[model samples]
Target: MLTAERKRKLLEVLQSEGKILASELSRRFGVSEDTVRRDLRELDRAGFLQRVHGGALPRTPTSVEHKARQKESTDAKKRIGAAAAQLLRQGQLVALDAGTTPLAVLDRLAPDLSLTIVTHSLPAATVLAEHPRIEVVVIGGRLFKSARAGVGVATVDAYRLLRPDLCILGAAGLHPEAGVTTFDSEEAEVKRAMIAHAARVAVVVASEKLGTVAPHLITPAGRLTHLITDSAAADDLLAPYREMGVEVVAV
Candidate 1:
């Protein structure tokens, strides 16, 4: 087939599947692996896809709307959820941050695992309410409509009285240099308080968040005990956290 024809086919496949392995594409197209890589590169350059280790994923917008964002990249979130859920055990008090990723973690939680969960996330509180064994504590404060989270002086004050065994943080960005950050200042304060009050902190991020830095800084990389992301995360990208004594788990 012509090069243009093959490239077009590759784009179609990648669009439908949401991801495409280089080797598989090469085999299917009867082309060299280098050619497949080059095709992926071109597509990535055109903003059609993102090149992962051995594959390409459809280019997703970072400014995704809240409801749509919840469904996008679900497989990766599920894997991350499984890894995060494994960290929980009976009789431990946990704090779940409000975000699409943390909500995914709630879905994977074991029904029989008894724990007290303190959260300002309305969605998380609703999910935890249905779990018979888990005790849910909703932190009260002025509600943030966009994020569906409560954040204010009241929320921070309430958090001070309870110390959690673990805090599962959902971040907007994770820069090796900038540490962890979020877009909203109030949310950043809440996250920082959660980090301070929890015995351990786990930052859950998708691979795309690794190199990106956001406006509001929350905590430094050293504060986290663990960083959980998808298996697609590059080892070199996560090495800095590992070097800082933070356990990095790729789900």
Candidate 2:
């Protein structure tokens, strides 16, 4: 078959399968593994798929800046955020992670709800401060402009100091295999600290991020106590998490 036609068929297979292995593609397309690798490399360079260790997975938009991502995911964020709020308890010390979806939790909280919240996200702290009954603890560090969050040693260290009753985590990617991932190493460190110190951790993410893998990992998917997402995510997309013993809440 022609190279162009083979590449087209490769993408079609990738779309339907959600992942691709070079050896399998080589067998299917009647090409050598090296040719399959080259095709995947070109496709990765074109921003169509993200190359992984042995194959490629769908690319996630977690690299997009916080503001631009806000322009997307309108209703899904609201529904997921509201469902996350239901998981909260009064007078709890909450660790809020940095991301649009995690930050959305503040919007759904009752005005009179009493809680203490800690965060490394400048944007998240800004919103939590508006709640008079909620005490806000800001973790200081270098600002990560893309996600409007703080990153660095201080942010990681502060999270180690206290055990939050619950943590509202966020992810750039949430694959059943790759687990909870983000785009930045420092951000992953900060999130890891939160996971280690929180009594229970809940991730609030959009449906589109399911089955996708990001570059850096915060924790394995099994580490999460709760996986909350929009109902647009299919049952099959969420079954692995449930099998991992996580409480899956699809809003």
Candidate 3:
């Protein structure tokens, strides 16, 4: 298995079992004890686990924090962000979806560009607040505390009034057959509104989210005009999206 897949599986095992012995993991995965220990240490640094003497234990359960999630794939997100930012034009109105990848796009936005940005993401709004040239409009609605973004009917109503030039859609999953899906139903509604209101839709996804499907369906594969991802995405996995006429931009 690839290292990323192995590490993700290791984390899943630790989460499911509460604790995992290094020796057991080494034996199960056919890897050395030293390799298991190294993996445990890396997971510890990522705040996913606590390394014990010869094993690892699950970290304390806590609500997912938006800022913490944004820091997870900093480099890959930056590349995706830069690529998304390049798609923007001066004086165009755009809608940015909530999530770490889109927030990265907000970070890379040029301060001197004249544009209007509409978003329900608090982090995205906060980042764009620093820019003097960009007009940042925060969609007011009931806040989803875990995501630190607005959702529900009020946010959906706000989106109906403004038709944007582009919308940067975030994804929990982007399967070839399943299309785009999210973890929450309300978030899915919000994404659907974003898709409907924008003239063109661009999905900002990390490599890991490529094949994974969540419970909530947002839009079909054909709705997206562009797919922006990192270089870590597989060619075979991206082929379906390309076949559907979606321009895949791997950063």
Highest lDDT: give the candidate number.
2
On lDDT, who's better, 2 or 3?
Answer: 2
What is candidate 3's lDDT per residue for 1-251, written digit by digit as tens?
67788799898886566467999988899999998898888877887765656786544322246767766767988999999999899989999999888888977777688999999999888888889899989998999987899999999988878889999998877767667877689989998988896888999988877765555689988899999999998898799899999999999
Q: Residue by residue across 1-251, what tens digits does model 2's lDDT show?
A: 99889889888988899899999999988889999999989998988887887888887765568888887787999999999999888889999998889888889898888888898889888888778788898988898899898899988889988899999999989988878888889999999999897889999999999988777889999889999999999999999999999999998
Regions more than 4 Å wrong, model 3:
1-65
C-alpha positional error of residue 90 in candidate 2 after TM-score superposition, expressed in Å? 2.3
Per-residue lDDT for 1-251 in model 1, tens only? Answer: 88789879988986566458899988998889999999888877886666666876554344434576687668998889889999998999998999888888988887789889999999899988899899899998999877888999998888877789999999877856667877689988888888787899999988877765555789988999999999888887799999999999997
Q: Going through the candidates in order, what is the number of backbone clashes in each?
A: 0, 0, 0
> Cα lDDT of all candidates, in order?
0.83, 0.88, 0.83
What TM-score, computed on C-alpha atoms, does each candidate reach?
Answer: 0.75, 0.95, 0.74
User: For candidate 3, what is the lDDT?
Assistant: 0.83
Give per-residue lDDT, candidate 2, residue 55. 80
| lDDT score for candidate 1 against the true structure | 0.83
lDDT of 1 at 52: 62
Deviation (Å) of 100 in candidate 1: 0.7
